[model samples]
Target: MSVALPACPSCQSEDVVKNGRTRHGKQNYKCRDCGRQFVENPQWRIISEETKGIIDRLLLEKLPLAGIARALQISELWLQQYVNQKYKLLEREVQVRPKPKSRLRVQMDELWSFVDHQGNKQWVWLALDAQTREIVGVHIGNRSAASAQALWQSMPPVYRQCAVIYSDFWSAYELVLPSKRHHAVGKETGKTSYIERFNCTLRQRISRLVRKTLSFSKKLDNHIGAIWLFIHHYNASLPANSSCPL
Candidate 1:
């Protein structure tokens, strides 16, 4: 009779030895090759990929953090951590993806949201490709020239050669954007109507962005993370008919 032994998880080596038992009474194994220890039948601390998919769907549905936790049978702290980690990765991916090759006509605008129970307001500055309906850049901070500049700088270099940038008559827009490309117009003139409608879509799809809602973020970090997640998902989910280079 032969007994089957499990391979080391760290190195996938058969050179593993019993190292006693874990606190939970699971059998512990140590890999001689890598000098790493792991427990057999270990309790998983990280969220599974299936749970991540559910989380992504719930986020798009504009569910509150607490509500999502309750629905998934997980702690709010765990869910928050998971979301932050995932969004940070998505942010890096977005930053490194290939930039659009052609020059773009863009629309820029800001939307308001509050963080913390103190009602400290934060502004979300967004730049959208007017023709493609794609989000090109995003910045979150106080409504000031610095935030506007950051938003403008966040845009891909390929988009900076814009034929015209339609924006409202916000002083920050004038201060941060180049004078030659900027076109500050009134909202009633339909210059920035596309971005304004996108703002409404954001509020409808992201619970934390909804005005006058109990789903507001209590921390600035979490608020920013939620925004990144929504932007990445939203851009990926756009219909082919509504995509770039119109």
Candidate 2:
């Protein structure tokens, strides 16, 4: 049986024909209508622009790049480039996310993870919108009082005024978080559970953070860059002008 293929997207005409092959031997296509040329590959099957929304949704919902490649029937590296470029460019234009009205409690916590560095595990401090279950900000570095302060400092200027800040018995949290922000600490405080579970979510969503991966992180910056991509999409999925409900 002959494999059916798509006509050129630009031309929308069957007058499309294979022009030759590239160095990679991928069939090159030419459109008679517009004289435009393209390669017919899985990457082109779904236009990158259109796939950006799907890619964003997948990332927001915590789908790993491997999972996205499998589900979308595209190359993992191709999908990675698509997402990396799309959001990186998107981030430039948008910069940091604007703080939305969040009804849920906010929580902050840091976790110790290893990299190739010759030292002990570094830390990534995350601030989460407890209700929406989205990571609002992440601070990376040593977990000193200064590092902790730096992490919490990265939140959008607005969310720094969250109604409640939940964290473990970390003394540094008490130092920087203001009184009006209600800090829940001590062993008895149940507020840390949400952020702790969020750590598990990150572990599952990102291969680099996973305990067992062929490519476990060796660089802290790469670890943090993944978090950036994760947070951008996570915030986009929520209903506009409000925190994520459900």
Candidate 3:
């Protein structure tokens, strides 16, 4: 009598062989066709839709991954994997109504953050539509003229051509922004108060961005993704007709 072997979980290939035992003495197998290895009869937890929805809400709040996992009774590894998948599929473009041929004012600002360690500094550049209070553009990179230019290029074409940009006296703004449409003002002038307040909101809501916090991001991609995710949620929650939806 012969017993049938389990097929490969990844490719569903039957060309599999027993490789070895896992550290916990579970049977491990390797697939010849897909070169994939997995444990036999592995216990996989199925996250319920309700649990996933709860996780989504927690992600937008000022909570750490460990705290979220603990509260949801899920493993940290699984929660991290879920978050990775969620962020990877986020839309890259900001959804907003185009106000072409109109005199629009935009507030531009840059905030500093780090990934993995303090040495790996990353600057988050943002452009906000003054009237709509929508985050119309974003670029994550070093604090340089190239990043400023990238932020400008990321804005919708109409805003880029017609919007008057108000920012601080950062030399990069002077180097990249058009002198005719750019105004570098001090904080006392109140020109950039909108973006400044939004930055404060960002730090308050995103745990990883909170100053003096131990919950800093370990990867740059996830850090940037979290910010964009919150931006989309915020724009969606605004009054109707404020912006287009993606």
For candidate 3, the C-alpha RMSD (Å) to the true structure equals: 6.7
Candidate 1 per-residue lDDT over residues 1-246, each given as its tens digit: 966568988789998888998888888888999998997666456678898888888987788979999898777888888777766666522442344566567899999998986359999999887776888889999999999999888887777764468899989999988899899999888889889998998899889887888888887888888888778877776666645422
- Which has the greatest lDDT? 3
> What lDDT tens digits, residue by residue, belong to model 3 across residues 22-57?
889988899999999998767666889999999999
Best by TM-score: 3
lDDT ranking, high to low: 3, 1, 2
What order do you get sorting by TM-score, best first?
A: 3, 1, 2
Query: If scored against the real structure, what TM-score would every candidate get?
Result: 0.74, 0.59, 0.81
> What local lDDT score does residue 148 receive in model 1, on the 0 to 100 scale?
94
Local distance difference test values of all predictions, in order: 0.81, 0.68, 0.90
Q: Select the stronger candidate by TM-score from 1 and 2.
A: 1
RMSD of each: 7.0, 6.6, 6.7
* Candidate 3 accuracy as TM-score: 0.81
